[model samples]
Target: MPAYEIDGYDNLIAGMVQPIVTQSIIINQATDAKFERGTVLARTGFTEEGMWVCTIVNSEATPAEEKVPVGVLADEEVDATTAQQRATAYVSGEFNRDALIFGGTDTIATHEAALNAAKIYTKRVVK
Candidate 1:
């Protein structure tokens, strides 16, 4: 399998909804080269921190111009600038890893679920 680069953002919106936006790069197998760009997945929301988990099901790459309709569920209306800022902050090592699980979970299921869901959006880029 080819190596993939995953990058995205998630913001808690209203109710139990958290919008997740992702872009992934799929390496080209034929030329042993990186794909030109990535593809957007969806514009849907997931349950906030519980109830369910979303893992990286899979990914594929294409041209950047090809816009894929991804979901967005933010409590506050997020503009393109804000989204870009969040993405940059994420890539710039501004987020706290431990803060993700600041409060201890009451149950193993809950903790495991949060970890699994978080792994989908966790990029190790240190800036």
Candidate 2:
């Protein structure tokens, strides 16, 4: 067997890192309103807490927001020196554990257990 690197990356340890993708939207803050980073969001039907990141809205969500989990506000404020962040508007990309209903747990559960845990994920991660 042989170990190797590709594209200047240490291939042997590639699995150690998982880069989750995210996006941001202007929540249209008022005089005192502001949103913070790592805020979970959805298209429609928000609750008092959880399942939502921002407290403000630009307008009533059109057709239940972007039709899927629009990711979170990767950048809560402007960056004077550089871009706050970068991401795609719409696409299935990796997200931090906070994006998931159940925070990232590494337990190797059985099929049924994993399915049970992933149920809410399936419903919220997207439409």
Candidate 3:
């Protein structure tokens, strides 16, 4: 399992925070192994019951790498893939528009500054 950290701003103001994750996600593979604590995730879209399924966010270029982080997964356990109350919301915190997160996959083609975008310290995926 890969582990990602929630770096950058820790002392975020209450208003800048948003609910990027949902509580209790029902997924196709419900072993619960995919939901590692602190791993960033994306949605598997909406279900018939209007629930958004959660999965590990995959990198576009690397595929095995992380993607635009929606938020961090809280430590949990559930066995059913298509289960109710199987997920918890991992929220996002951005202090301002300049807020940096360490998981962005975009790169500039031309010359760029070291701090071209908001940056957060990220721990790479361990295969």
Task: State the number of backbone clashes in model 2.
Answer: 2
Compute each candidate's TM-score over C-alphas: 0.17, 0.29, 0.42
lDDT of each: 0.22, 0.30, 0.40
- Summarize candidate 3's per-residue lDDT along 1-127 as a digit string, tens digits: 1122336643222232333323555545645434435444555567878876656554452543234444445544333444544555444432221222223453322102222231212222222
Q: Assess candidate 2 and give its lDDT.
A: 0.30
**Per-residue accuracy of model 2 over 23-56 as CA lDDT, tens digit each:** 3333323343333443333334333443332322
Strongest candidate by lDDT: 3
Q: Kindly indicate the candidate among 1 and 2 with the higher TM-score.
A: 2
Deviation of model 2 at 18, angstroms: 8.1
Better of 1 and 2 by lDDT: 2
Clashing pairs in 3: 24-87, 25-87, 30-81, 100-118
Total clashes in model 1, counting residue pairs 3 or more apart in sequence or in different chains: 6
What range of 10 consecutive residues in model 1 has the weakest lDDT sum?
85-94
As for TM-score, the candidate ahead, 2 or 3, is 3
TM-score top scorer: 3
